[model samples]
Target: MPGSLARFRACFERSPRTVVLFVVIVIALYVGIRDIAGDAIIETLDSHYPANEPLRDILRTARNYHRHPVEPPYKDKFWEVGQRSRNLSRWLAELNGPWGSQLRGFEKERLGTAIETTATSLFPFLSPPPPKQGSKTPLRDLQRSFTKDSRGIVIPAGGSDLQIRFAGHLIASLREVFGCSLPIQIAYAGDSDLPKERRDALLSFDKTNNTEFLDVWTVFDDATLRLRRKGWAIKAFAALASRFEHVIVLDADAVFLQSPEVLFQQRAYVENGAYLFHDRLLWQHSFEDRHEWWKDQIKEPSPAMNKSLVWTEDYAEECDSGVVVLDKSRTEIFVGLLHIAWQNTWAVRDEVSYKITYGDKETWWLGLELAGSKYEFEEHYGSIVGWEKEGSPDDKAVCSFVIAHTDEKDKLLWYNGSLLKNKLVDPNGYEVPLYWMMDGKWEKGGKKDMSCMVGETRRRLTGEEISILQHSIEAALRVDEVIASMKES
Candidate 1:
C-alpha cells in the first residue's frame, strides 16, 4: 500500500495538469450517461414485480377517482385556424393593393349582404333576440337541473322525413350507448313540413324529461324592433347564448353510433371554448349542394389570370356544421358567430369583381376568419361525420348519410362487425360494410334496399328498434309520395 501510494503521488506531482483533466473527464462521462438514460423511459415497470407492487396499487386506485380536469378545449385547432385567417387576410390585402380591401369591398355592396338579409328575413327566430340575460322566457330555462354539467345537446332539424328517420336512429343509439343521458334540444325549423305523427313519435324518445323542442317555424314578430328580424340561424346562436353553459350542435340527419360523453370530457373540450372540424367537403361547389354561400358575393379571378397582379378566386366553403361543441365561456366568439350568421347577407359574383358570400356554413367560417385574431379557435383534424355519398361510386349521390367520430384510444370505428362491401366507405373515409343489390333490391334483408347495413357492431338494433326503423321507413315513403305528387301537380 505504501509503494502504490508513493507511485500515485509521484505521478500527480510530475503532472498536476494531467490529473485535473482526467478527473474532469470522468465526472463529465458520468453526467452524460445519466442524462442519456433518464427521461427516455416510456413504459411502467411490470406490476407483478415486487418493487412495483405499491405503484401498481396506486395506479389502479387512481382509475376510480379520475375526474376530467377543467381545461380549455382544442387550443391547437383554434391556433391553427386563427393563423390561417391571418394569412388569408394578408393575402387578400396584398391582392387588393392601393385601393386595398376597399376595391374588393365593392362586391359586398353589389349583392352579398343584401341578398342574404332578404333571404334570412323570411325566418323569425333570428330576428328576435333571445330572452334577456338572467330573465325567464320560453327559450331560457334557468331552473333546469343537470347531471354532469349544464351542457345541452342541440339537433337542428330541416323538417325532412329522412331527418326524422335519422333522428330516431340517433336517439335510439344514444339511449343504448350513452343511456339516453342528455338534455337534448330539438330546434325545429319547419313545423308545417313535419307531420303530426312523426313529430309525436320524435317527442316520445324523452321519457326522462330530457328532451325539449324549440318551434323554429313560427314567425313571431317583435314590434318594438326597427331594421330587420332574426330567423332559423338563431337556433344555433340561441343555444350558445341561452342558459346552457356548453352546447353540442348537431345536424338532425347525423347519427351517433357511440356515446359522445367521451368528447365532452376530453382535454380539448374542457380546455377550450369552441371545437370545430375542418371543412373536408371543400370542392368545386354547385347549387344542388344546398350550401350556397358562394353565390351571395363571390370573387372570380380576372381573364388575364397569369398576368394580373391581383388575383381573387376566394369562394365560400361548407364548414362541416354537423358537429360543433360550443362553450358559453367564449362569449366573444359565440356572440361574434351569432352576429355574422344573422347578418342577412350572402356573397355573390358579378361580371367584374368577386366578393365573399355569407351562407350559414360560410358565415360560420367567415366569423372564425374575422374573429380568429380576436378570439381563440380550436380546429380539429380528425375523422368527421355528416351527409355524404356512400356505396358504389357509380351510383347517384347518397343523401342523409350517417357517420360518427369518437376520439382516439377508444377509437373503435368498427362498422357492421367485419363486413366491407364493394369498396364502400362511410362519410369519414372509413370503410363501412356495403350491401348488394339482387333482382332489383338491396340484399340486406329489409323490405326495401333503403339502408346499406342491418346492424352496428358496438350497438346492434334490438327487435323493437328494428320495428321502429321499419315503421319510420314506411312513413318516410309515404311522405316522399306526397312530395312527389305535390311536385308533379
Candidate 2:
C-alpha cells in the first residue's frame, strides 16, 4: 500500500494537468455522494418525524428561502428513529381510504390571513372586555411545590366523557413519567361536565396530590366565543385564565407513553417562549369531512395561508394540537391561534358556534400560521407501541412499537387501528424483547422477517406486564368504587 501510494504520488507529480483533472473528478464524486447521503437521511427523518419541523428548521429558518419561525432542530437520534418507524405506518395509511363516516371530511379548512385580520380587527369595537382572568389559582394547595414561573399540565375534557373514565391511567402514567415535577390541572367544560363524584374520583389519584378544575363559563362566557362546540373555547380561556404561567395543554387521549419533561426543555419553549406539536394530518386529504365551514366565519380569505409551513414528502403528519407546551412568553402566539378558532365559521342551524366540528384545531393551525410562531412540538417526535400489518405470510398482527390509536389525534390511526385489530396475541405473556423507545426502531432478529419497524419477529408483553397495564386502568375504577362504598358505609 505504501509503495502504491508513492507511485501514485509520483505519477500525479509527473503530470500537473492529469492531477488537476483527477482532483476535479474526486471533488465531483464527493459532492455527489454527499448530496445522495443527505437526501436519504433527510427523507428518512422527514417521513418518520413529520412533526419534527422545529428541529428540521435549523438551517431552513435561518438561511432557507422560506422562513421557519418555529423551534430549533431536534438532535435526538433515538427519537427520530422511533418516529420514522411509526411515520412509515402513517404514510401507508395515507394510501388507504379514510373509511365510512371519516370519508366525509377530506379537505382541511383553509383560512386566508386577510380574513383573520378582518375578523380580529373588529374585536375592539364588537367584542366585550376579555374575561376577567386573574392569577388567583384554584390549585393553591400545590403552590408549595410550584412557583409563579413554574409550568404545569392542562388536560381538557370537553363533553367527551372519556377523560374522567381514563383518569386513573392518566394520573398513574403522569406519576410514573413526571413524578410530580410539575403541577397538574384539569379543565372541564359543558353544562353537563363531570359530576361531583367523578370529579372527586379524579382527585383521588393521589391523596397528597390535588388538581384544579374550571367551570369554563367564568372565562369564556362571551357571545362571540360561544360558537365553539367542543368547549375548546374553555381551553382557549384556560390559555390565559389558568393560574400557571406556563402550561402544557394535553388531550385526555394523549396518554403519557413516557415522560414529557423534554418538551419543556425545547428551544421553542426556552428561547422563543412558545411551542406546539405538528398536526399529524394536513392538506385537504387529511380532513375527515367535506363541509366548507370557512365561508361564514370570516368575510375574507386567510392571509396567513401564503406563508404557512407544510410537511414534505419525507414527513407524513404535520400538526397535532392535542399536545402543546407554551409559556406566557409565547401567549401572543397562542392567542393568535385562539383568535382564528373563535372567529372561524358562524354556527349553522342546530350547529354550535364555530359551527365547525374541529374548529379548535383548525383555528389553532391558522393562528400559528398567521403569527408565524416558530416553536413546534413535531420536532420532538415519538410514538406508542401496538401491532401492525404486513404482507401474506407475514399478515398476522405483530406486536411492535407501532403508531396506532383510535383517537383522532393519531396520525396513522386508520392504518394502525386496522393492524391492531388483531390485538397483541399473548395469553400466557411471553417475553419478546421489549420495544425500547430509546432504541428508536425495533431491533433486528437474525434474518427472520418480522413485519415490525425493524422488520423482525413480533413481541408481546408477559402476563405480569399485561396485568400491570390493565391494573392501572382497573385501579382507577376500583378506587372510585372503594371511595363510594366507604362513603355508603
Candidate 3:
C-alpha cells in the first residue's frame, strides 16, 4: 500500500492537471451516488410510515430538485426549492452527529421564517392582523344564542322497528325530562325501499310535533345509490343544512341523554365554519384502506387535507357521530366539496375511492382545509362514555353531566343508573351534571358554572326508574365483557 501510494503521488506530480480533472470527476460521482442513496432512504422511510406520505413525498421531491435543479410538474408554485431546502435543513437538524448540530441553528432561524411564509400562503386568514389590545366588548356583545328547544324530530334509518320504538321512547323521555318540545321524526331505509307505512309514520310524527319530516328520499335522489352517491348526498345536505344559523345532523342510532344546546355555545366561536367532534380512530380507519390514495392526494402543501396536521391518539380512542353542528356560511363550501367528492367516489370503488372521497369526516376536514375555514373540536361530544371493556373508574367520571349517548339499551341503563344514583341533577331547575361541566362543583371565585338543575321534586325514584337503571347496569357490564373478549380475539 505504501509503495502504491508513492507511485501514485509521483504520477500525480508529473501530470497535476490530469490528476486534478480525475479528482473532480471522482468527487462528482461520489456526490451523485450519495444523492441516489438519499433518495432510496427516503423511499424506504415512506413505505414504513405511509401515513406521512404527503410530507415524505414533499421532502423527496424537494431533495430531487435540489440534487438536480429541475422544475416539478405540479402547479403549486408556492412549494419551491427554497421551501424544500428549509425542510431538508430541518430534517437534518433533527438527526444525530456533527452535521445535525451545525444545521440546527440555521434550521431554527430559517424554519421560523419558512413556516410562517408557507402557512400564510396555505392559510391566508390565519395571517389577519391582530386587533389592538382592548376590551373584547365587540366579541362579547355578539348576541350568541344557544337555546335547547324540544322541537326537532328523530329519524331512524337502518335499525329494526324495536330499535325505532326504543329510539322514540328515548326521545320522549328526553323531552319529558328536559322540557324540550321538539318532536322526533323516525324513518327506515334498509333493504326495502321507503315503505308507505314508514312514510305515514314519519308524517304522523311530524304532524303531531308541527315539524317537517325529512326522509332519505327528500335528502337524496336515491337512497340506494351506493356508497359514493350516499356520501355526496349527505355532504350536499350537510352544506345546505348549514344555512340555518344553527343546524345539527346526527346518525340515527345516537341517543340524546341531555340537551344539545351545550355544543352550540362552543360552536359560536367559529365565525366562518362549524365545529365537529372527530374520533381519531374513525379517521385512522377511514384512511387505513386508502393509504395509497391519501399519499397521492397530499402531494402539495395542504394543512387541512393532511391527517398529520391533527394530533394522533391510540386505537382505543373513539369518536361519536351522534351530533354535528354547522354554521350556515361554511355549509355552502362543504356542499360544493360534497359534489366533487361524490364524483370522485363514483369514478372508483374500494380502497382509493373510500380513502379519497367516501367518509364525511375526511371530506369535512378536507373541505375546511380548502376553504381555509376555522373549526373548533369538541372532545366530549366524540367520547365513548359508557362502553369501556373494563368498567373503568373513568366511566364513573362521565356520569357528571349530559352526554350524547351511543351505547345500546344496556349501556344506556347503566348511564341512567349512574346519573340517578349520583343525583347529578339537583332540585330547582338548574345544576345538571355534565362530564365536561360539573353540576355544582365550581370554585367560588372561578368561572361561573352554567348548568340548569331539575327541581328536587323530580329526584324521587319511581319503581320503573329503579328497575330500568338496574337492568341497564347489568347489561352494560355484560356488553363490556363481550367487547373485551372480541378485542382479545
Best model per lDDT: 2
Q: After best superposition, candidate 2 residue 64: deviation in angstroms?
A: 36
Best model per TM-score: 2
2 versus 3: better lDDT goes to: 2
- Candidate 2 clashes: the total is 39
The whole-model C-alpha lDDT of candidate 2 against the native structure comes to: 0.42
TM-score per model over all chains? 0.43, 0.50, 0.41
Candidate 2 lDDT by residue in tens digits, 241-313: 4567677776664544335565676555676566655432223344333223323222232343322333222
lDDT of 3 at 231: 31
Any idea what lDDT model 3 has?
0.36
Off by over 4 Å in 3: 1-163, 166-170, 182-192, 202-208, 216-220, 227-245, 267-272, 280-319, 330-360, 379-382, 387-489
TM-score, cand. 3: 0.41
Q: Give the TM-score of candidate 2.
A: 0.50
Clashes of 3: 23
Please give the range of 10 consecutive residues that has the lowest summed lDDT in model 3. Answer: 137-146
Ranking by TM-score: 2, 1, 3
lDDT of each: 0.39, 0.42, 0.36
lDDT of 1 by residue, 1-489 (tens): 999989878889999867655555565556645432221111112221222333233333222122221122222122222333333333233323453334334432322222223222221234433443222222112213212247778765445554664565455455544475877776654455455665666666545657776543332222311112323344444354344567777655443434555556655566556555433222233332222322222222122222211112221233455666666544344434443433322211111111233234444544543344232223222232211234654442222232223443434221211111221232122232222111111112222222332212213234543343344334334444544454476
